[model samples]
Target: MAYVITKLCLNCKDIACTQVCPVDCIYEYKGDDPSIPKEMLLIDPDECIDCNACVPECPWEAIFEESEVPDIFKDDIELNARIVGKERFVPKRNPDDPIPTPEQIAANKEKWGYKP
Candidate 1:
């Protein structure tokens, strides 16, 4: 199964995952928020070789396997796929870019408005 990015990543926006992504499959748009949604990370299942490279990379523990995820997090399965394919809820951020600063995180909250 492929990895999925869940709600726990909503405001965290940590780039730790990107650092360890050996395949460059984990990606973001770099401060552009093109979809006008929260600046969250997404794994490209199509590109992901299921190497499990990113699962341990996340400090917030937002990434998971489809079956390993809790029921409440099942929806993230499709959400991750959708974001990967359509960039539907994806906010633009570069995969190689640095994580958002604390101040930028706060500003992102204002722009994306995730639930606490």
Candidate 2:
């Protein structure tokens, strides 16, 4: 199983996880959101080697093993896979890149607002 990035990362956009990721599985959307804030970070499960390198690397404590993740956040695993492509794990865009469309922000905001 792979690790997941949960809602705790929203508005925090910390990319420390990305810098520490050896496989570059961790990426931040950099376009609209520069500095790849926690809100923009999404782990590419496809590219992830399940190295656990990013778990401790996260300052916000957002990363967690798939099994260890809470039920509320477990869906993030599928979300990451779908967004990044289930078969091809490489990030569709740079983690430092941001696509701040209202839709993008709204989708993430919905999850962030619930904050389970």
Candidate with top lDDT is 1
Clashes of each: 7, 15
How do the residues 87-113 of candidate 2 rate in per-residue lDDT, one tens digit apiece? 222233246744355455456546655
TM-score of 1: 0.64
Worst 10 residues of 2 by lDDT: 85-94
TM-score of each: 0.64, 0.62
| Alpha carbon lDDT at 76, candidate 2 | 75
Q: Which stretches of candidate 1 lie over 4 Å from their true place?
A: 29-36, 85-116
Query: Residue 52's C-alpha lDDT in candidate 1?
Result: 81
After the best TM-score superposition of candidate 2, give how far the Cα of residue 51 lies from its true spot, in angstroms: 1.0
> What's the C-alpha lDDT at position 77 in model 1?
77
Q: CA shift at 95, candidate 2, in angstroms?
A: 16
**Model 1 clashes, total count:** 7
Question: What lDDT, from 0 to 1, does candidate 1 have?
Answer: 0.64
